[model samples]
Structure formats: structure tokens, C-alpha cells
Target: MTDKTVLTERNGRIATLRLNRPAAMNALTADMLSLLGDELEAIAGDKGISVVVLTGEGRAFTAGVDLKALRDSGQDLTEGNVGDALNGAARWVQQLIERMPQCVIAKVNGFCFTGGVELMLACDIIIAAEEAKFGDTHAMIGLRPTWGMTQRLGRKVGMQRARELSFTARTITGVEAAAYGLAMEAVPLAQLDSRVDELAQAIAKNSPGSIAAYKDLYRKSENAGLDAGLAYEYETKYEIADVRERMAEILKRLGG
Candidate 1:
């Protein structure tokens, strides 16, 4: 499925969603956010797709919300209606991606700023290209982030580093992002696509039902205390059927 702003391509059990606004650095306008949300919702219902990769068509994963679009809309921020609508749509997209049963990977090939960073945080994993740039420029633009950036950024990196990055609005290289625990890893720019594909295929090879259950359990555990998380995990394990059969198959494959 190809839209003017977003493109979706499926290869077997994996789907790739590309932000198509290369000239605009794949900035998220309100319309683009809505389109992305629709696409993601469709993917969530697709039982055939077990993995989703999100990237950009050009030099940026996304530059974040389109400031120019907001400006041109002549919407008064003080009134809050327009701003709230845009933020609400962006939030819905993030939540949809986060709650989807399929594993979502952010292929950060280039610039990822503000809302883009928030979008990446919502994914299950992020693999960035070495030359990719990341930043939170909300403070620099005289606006506070309406998305989950404030909370997610601090959680991924330490609060101190998050504070410095947001306050200074300084861009970090992909290498620095990995070191700071923002990205899973940074690879050579030339190998970014292949690396993401490899990881996605690895994930796709697993049992979809088990993977979905684990993804949901992990999300639930993140918010629960250790004791509660442990209890929840223990209880959830019984929910998966054919455990013994699957284990036997694994052992047989290993020649046990």
C-alpha cells in the first residue's frame, strides 16, 4: 500500500513502512500521522505479518512534526484545538505501534528528531545507521514535547543525559545513541537495510503466537514491580498451549 506520504511493502511475513516525504525529511504532518495510523491499524489485523520495519525513503527516518505545516495552517496554539488534534493523532499512532502484536523495528537510517525519536521509542527495537542523527529539538523551538519524548527519552537514557540532550538540543550520532542505550546498535550506513532485514527475518522465524504473547507480557511487566512482574510472568506462561510439543520439537531438531 503506497500513499503520498507513507508506503507499505510486504515481503512474506515482514512488512516495511517507509516515510515517503524525502524532500521534507519525512516530517510528520497531521495528514501523514493519520495515514500512518491507518496503515498501522491495518497491519495489526494482518495475521500473516509477524514483523514490521519502519524507515524512511531518503535522508531521514523523520525530522518530527512538520513545523512548516503547522505554521501554514495558521492555527493558534493558545486555543489548543489544532495543536491538540495533531498531538492526539501522533499519540494514537505511537500507541497503535506499541500495542501491535507484531514486532516493530525502527530502522533509523538518518535524522530522527523530537517526534521521530518518540516514534522510535514506541518500537520494540531500533537499529540505527552509524551516520544517523538524533536529537530532541523541542526546547530549541520554544515548545515542549507533546508526545512521549519527555518520559521515554529519560527512561531509555538516564535522566541526566536526557536532560542535557533536550536542554541543549544537541544532535547525537548513532554511535553515541547506542552507547547511551537509545538504540540497540549502530551499524555502517551501507549495511543498515540488510542488518534490519536480518533481524526482522530472525524474529519472523519464531512462533508468531509465542512471540505475540511474550511481547504483551514484556510490555505489561515493564510497568509492574519486580514481584508483580514475576507473578505475572509465571501466570502467563501457562496460557501458552502446546508448550511440551514445541519443546519436544526443539529437542528433536537438536538431536537430543
Candidate 2:
């Protein structure tokens, strides 16, 4: 379970996953990605976990993938094994986020760049501290965003903004990211923890099945046009009510 690189804790209705390599600003390692993938799968069907928050152990959220490890391993970043390894790890993380039943949120604080941005993009919601910074450093680092960042970033912040971030490798503050729709909100560092908790709790109180259905719809309709989205909405019209049926039964049992 690569506890050194990643840590997980169940907090009532919320499950918090932490990137634990603080010495290197919690850079994503291959083992960490693998463990995270497995953990997400394990909790996918757990009704106890209504929300999941991905955060860092110390100061920075993540500096991105571990470049030193790849270089030292003599990995061929040009083509072949290196590219495959990097792509595979990134995909694992993305798939984990997509498949998890829990509402995934990114609690960002300081330096989120390159692969870091890719990870945050995977989250359903992102809450950042004022000190947080986001950037697509692939161009500057001589690498490319092959981890669905190109696909998702544009959808989140528009193509023009995406190009500017990826090509120019310019950093954006938390407030700027929020304004650009990259982050849900930017709070003071002191308020970051409480804000994440507040958001998670608000989500946790909702019916799990309803939340899951809505999340699924959001993912499917993100790229859909108005007509297609309308069809999807109509198809899932009774989703919330269907899940609420059991609520009445539970209330009856409680004599509510």
C-alpha cells in the first residue's frame, strides 16, 4: 500500500487521501499512483464513504511527477517505455477518480503544476488556499500533457485559457484559478481545512445514490451538446426521486 507515498483515513462520511512525500512536495511516484488506484477501487462501493478529499500531507499539494526518479532510471522520455509508464500511471489516477463512488475533491494548497494540474483536474471539485498556484509546466519541462489534461483543462477553463497555461507554462494563483473556473473557491490558508470540511459535509448529507447518478450524468454530459444533454437529463429525471424512496421507509421506521 505504499504508505510512505500515500496515506488514507476514513473520517465518518468522508475519506481523505493524502499524498505523503512532503520532502519533495508530495510528488507523484509510480507506487503512489498504483496504490491510489487500488484504494479508489476498494472504496468505490462503500456506502460509508460519501465524499473523498485528495490532499497533501505538508505544505504544497504536489510539485508534479517525480522527474528525478525517471531521469535516474534512465527512462526514455522520448518514446517507448518511459512514455508508456508515465501515461499508464496518469491514466490509473484518472480512472480511479472517475470510478470512485465517493464525490472526489481536491484540497489544493501551494504549487500544483504539470502532473499536479492533471490530478486536480480529475477531482469533481477543487478547493484551493490563497497560496495555491497552478500551472501546466510540460512545455517548460520539455514534456507534454498526455494525461488527459489537454482534454479536461479546456473543458474546465476554456481552450484559449488552456493553451495559454500549457504553452506559456504560466502560473495562476488560487483566486485567478477560481475566477477562471479551475477551482471552486480560494480561501485563506487558515480557512482551507474548514472550507474543505464544510463542502464535503454538505455533499455527504445528500443521498449517495442521487449524488452518484448526478456525477455520472455530469461526466457523460460534459462533452454533450444541448440536445444530447437534454436527452440525458430527461432520461435521469427520476434519478433523485428513485433514490429518495428508501428515505421515506427509513423515516417511517424512525416514526418521523
Candidate 3:
């Protein structure tokens, strides 16, 4: 088997990104993050692709940062080089998921912990299998989540729950994760693939421009205060107003 950190493939309108380091449980490295960013950027400009799904090969989605790589770096986590190498992947992948036009989905199975959990939170939709486990074990390992975990987790599952999860660094089952709103849905391991395909196909059938706008709306709303969100909605509505006008003109020309 290949040992690349990342792999990509286009399946008709759906692009699949697989984390391929299964021997290490797909623990992320800096190169993987850069590759994923490059892939997302490429897909953004490819009209043939309409949606993107992120998953991992073998038993785990990802085991977070590569512990062995950290040891090999011979640099303290507090230092610039090793920390940058370790965390940069998470940063770039998170940013790519946020800015990409395609509908991003996390098809998670097995261990989705620490950075894996943070990365999934970046996705627009997360669908996990029954056997998957989600957690933030950073604190347990004498580290803290420096990603957007503190901000996004609470918005996902509420402040109280986020505090409990991050502070305790406990593992939550896929079903419990679904209940906490961490996942969009949880399916049996056997049916997970079909469910992801069904959802991806449904998303791919929608207007690409409309889907992009919808995803942006969530991001803006998530970061905005009530008043600011309302203002953003108005601005977005004004922007889309032109699309409606053009649509009407097209229908008129067709004598519909």
C-alpha cells in the first residue's frame, strides 16, 4: 500500500479526499495539510466537481497529529519549527474547508479525536459510522487544543457541553456525538458509505452558485453577533438579487 499522507480522486461530480497514512492511523503531518489545501484549491476552480468528501483509509479517519513525527522533530512543542509543522496542517485544512466553494462533508469512521475532531467541525456536514469515536484528548496528553476548537465546539454543541468535552478530554461515541449536534447523523458502519453518497449526490444536483452562497451564509452567521448577522443577511440578499433578476430575464426570453 502507498504511504502518502493525502490522496484525491474525482468521482463524477463528487471529489473524494482520503487521508492515506493508515499505518499510523492517518495521523496528520504538515505535508498532508499542504496537499489537502492544494487539492481543495484545485477543485474550487474545477467546474466538473460539485462537492467534496473527506475521509480516511483503513480503520481510522485520523489519529490527530503524528506523535512519532513530533518525537523525530527533536523540537519542543513550544518552539516555532515543530509547532508550525504540527499545527500548520490543521490550520490550512480548516481554512480550505471554510473557503472552498464545494459542499464539504466529513465521512468519518473510527477514531476522530483531537485535531480530527477539529477538522470535522470545519466541515459543513459530518456523517459518522456507528463505531466511530470522537474526542479531544489534548488535555489528557498535557496539551491544549490551539485550533478553532474552543470557538467552534461551543457553537456546535453549546458552551457548557464544549467545556465538558474539552476539559475532560473524554471520548464520545458516534451516537452520543449526534445527540450533541457534533455530527449531522450517525449510521451503522455497513450503511455509512451509501448515506454519504446519497447526501453528496443530492448536494451535487443543486445550483453550484446557490450552494456556495448557502455555505458562506452559515460562516458569516456563525461569526457575527445578532445585529451584525442581520446586516450580513441584508448584504447577501442584495448580492443574490442580481441572480434572481438574470434568472427572470432568462425565463422571459424562453417565453415561460
| lDDT digits (tens) for residues 1-256 of candidate 3 | 6666778989999999999988888887778878888888898888788799999998999988777877787767653233766577678779889878789999998888888888899999999998899988888777767678888999889999999998999999889989999998999999999999999999997677777888887788888898998888778752333477668888999998
lDDT at 47 for candidate 3? 76
TM-score, each model? 0.93, 0.90, 0.90
Compared with the true structure, all predictions reach lDDT values of: 0.89, 0.84, 0.85
Order the numbered candidates by lDDT, best leading: 1, 3, 2
Which one is best on lDDT? 1
Residues 83-127, model 2: lDDT tens digits: 666679779878889757679999997889889889899899999
222: Cα error in model 3, Å: 0.4
lDDT of 3 at 63: 85
Clash pairs, model 3 backbone: none
lDDT for model 3 comes to 0.85
Question: Which prediction has more favorable TM-score, 1 or 3?
Answer: 1
The superposed Cα distance between candidate 1 and the true structure at residue 143, in angstroms, equals 0.8
